[model samples]
Target: MIGSLGLKLARFAVVLSVFALWEVLSRTGMVNPRLLPSASDTIAMLGQLLQRASVRSDLAVTASEVAVAFVLAVPCGALIGFAIAENRYFAEVAKPLLFFAFSIPKSIFLPMFILVFGVGFSQKVGFAFFSTIFIVIMSTTVAVDSVKTEYLTVARSYGATTAQTAFRVYLPSMLPVLLETVRISMIFNLTGVLLAEMYASRDGIGHQIATWGENFQMEQLLAGVLMIAIIAMTFNELVRWVETRCSHWRT
Candidate 1:
């Protein structure tokens, strides 16, 4: 544990070193201060936003949207994936359709979603769901396909029922990989929600950032950007921790 903590600290030190270099360069005019504010200035801006009630409210709304999208996505994606896995015919029938949907650019759907779901939370959820579904579906399908036939044969040899093979062999086999896919899809959904909010929102972190940018309030803009990076980083770290725990069985 001590050794693990040391490695984590060392990694953080490297990150801080890079930020320190950027701060020095920006402060000394080696880099354009206007274009690249020092880390200290960005941190001060972040502090200001954290103190404000409005930013907190905006963050809560955005978080709620993200959570909702994720909740809706996981079960649906898993079901589609599981269906395809259970039968080769269904896989062939569905794979092309799913691919076509994924291939279409997400931005193109914004107008349609707005038309259907309107400029509200429904639209945001739709955008987030659209952005992430394909990743989870495709990943889950691949994981299912990769399950060895030998395992199925062994189960059958032992007189395992179809349901038993699916539950004991197939489901357990896919859980870790499916979870990894979900983590990646979550990241994709987060980006989708933020971009959707930026496009059309009365209250969200993305909306606040856009508002600040429009007013050329560099400090506030920087603050919002910093907050986003922090949030994204937090998600990444949590996913990585879960991935590490889940994948230990693989080796």
Candidate 2:
């Protein structure tokens, strides 16, 4: 724990040093400050924006889309994973398909999603779901597939039913592995939301950044970026807490 804390502190120190470098460079006119605002200017804009509750509302909307996509993906992905795990024949067929599906650039489908969902929350959620669900599916499938034959044999020796073996062994054993997939899915959703907001939505942090960027208000753009970083860090910390709590059952 001490080592982990020290590592995080070191990372934060590095980030601060980078910002200081940028600040010095901009203030010294090494680059035009208009194109790259100083950290102080950006921080001031962040402070001012935080004073308005509406900015929080914009964040809430994007967060809501993220939550919705995650909820929709988790059960479906888990079920898909379970089906694939139960059959090697299907896994051989579907694994490549999943890889191809994941590799498809989602922006290519945005037009169809926007047309179907009418540039609304549903479309954004769909985009987020597309971006995240495959990761969850593939990871969970691999985790379940790799369960030891010995464990299954032991459960069968105990006269355990299929459901009992699954609940008591497979699912529990896969939790740690799935947690990593969840973390990756969350990052994917974050990127998807940013893209959706930038291209389609009128009321998200991405939209705000685009609007401000067009007006040459670098400070506001920086403020939006800072808010995104803060939200991502907070959500990631929550996920870490949940992971630690879930794994504590092992101890």
Leading candidate by lDDT:
1
Q: lDDT per prediction?
A: 0.86, 0.85
The weakest ten consecutive residues by lDDT in model 2 span 176-185
What RMSD does each model have against the real structure?
Answer: 2.8, 2.4
Candidate 2 global TM-score: 0.90
Counting clashing residue pairs in each candidate, in order, gives: 0, 0
Candidate 2 per-residue lDDT over residues 154-233, each given as its tens digit: 99999999889989988778787778778878888888877888888878777778888889998899878888898888
Candidate 1, residue 145: how far the Cα is off, in Å: 1.2
Which residue pairs come into collision in candidate 1?
Answer: none
Model 1 accuracy (lDDT, Cα): 0.86
The runs of at least 3 residues in candidate 2 whose Cα sits more than 4 Å from the true structure, single-residue gaps closed, are 1-9, 244-251
Candidate 1 lDDT by residue in tens digits, 1-251: 57998999999999999889989998999988887778899889899889999999999999999999989987788788878867889988999998888888887788888889988788889999989888888888888986789999999999999889989988878777877887789888998898988888888998899998888887788878888988888887887888788678888
Q: What TM-score does each of the candidates earn?
A: 0.89, 0.90
